[model samples]
Target: MKIGEVSGHASVPVETIRYYEKIGLLLKPDRDASDYRVYGNAHLNRLLFIKRCRNLDMTQDEIRELIRLSENPEADCHEVDALLARHLIHVRDRLSELANLETALQQLQQACSKTGTVEQCGIMGGLSSELGGLSDKDTDQRNHVPGTHKPGSH
Candidate 1:
């Protein structure tokens, strides 16, 4: 099969598949006589695995580590358990941060009673007020949501 075929079967974008290969998450497939990429069942299975991991919000590093561990069928499963536990902790933290964010936005929205002019917009005023600004700790807490791009990523 071709790249497009595999992508459709995996429900992943073609560019994402290429990116996974580039990042060493998915192994590069062999090329046909016309230099077009050729994919097989292995590629399809790997892409599906990657898609499932991504749907679970696992990071590339996490997926890579899981893949490595999977290669050794005889290896102990403790590492997988540990990795999932760590991921769950991160998910919980994000949920807490998101709840706080929702509360903050609600407060900001309540600052204004009704639709008004820009000058009378309480939400804007609250955002601009130095006294109402988020503290450094609050800012840090809000900034680390999952899937946020960090420095040095492509």
Candidate 2:
């Protein structure tokens, strides 16, 4: 099958497949005479797994670790259990941080009740020095800031 066919069957984008291959997550496919990528059942299965893991919000490092563990079929699954438990803790921490962010936003929003000029706005005041304007600590602890969301690049 061609790249497009594999992508459709796996429900993953072509660019994402290429990226995964580049990052050593997925193996590079064979090329046809025309230099078109030729994918096989293994590629399709790997892509499907990757897509599902991404949907679960798992990180690339986490996926890589999981894949490594999967390769040793006879290995105990205790490592996998520990990995998922750690991931769950991370998710819970993020949820708590997001709740704090939501409260901060709500308080900022409630600072102003009636529509008013910018000079008279409480919202503006909430952002001013007098109001101890928000200087939120960066909640995200990822290596990269994710400034631009390049597809499957993380």
RMSD of each: 3.8, 5.0
Local accuracy of candidate 2 as per-residue lDDT tens digits, 1-154 = 9988887888788899899999988989999999988999998888888888889888888899889999999999999999888777776765676677678678878898688798888777876853363233432334333112223333
lDDT (tens digit, per residue) of candidate 1 on 35-153: 99999999899889989988888888889989999999899999999988878877776677689778878999889968879899998888899456657543434245533322222
Kindly report which residue pairs in candidate 2 clash with one another. Answer: none
> By TM-score, who's the top model here?
1
Q: Show the colliding residue pairs in model 1.
A: none
Identify the runs in model 1 with alpha carbons over 4 angstroms from their true place.
130-154
Q: How accurate locally is residue 136 in candidate 1, as Cα lDDT from 0 to 100?
A: 55
TM-score of each: 0.86, 0.81
- Against the reference, the lDDT scores of all candidates come to 0.82, 0.78
Q: Which candidate is the best by lDDT?
A: 1
Q: How well does candidate 1 match the true structure in TM-score terms?
A: 0.86
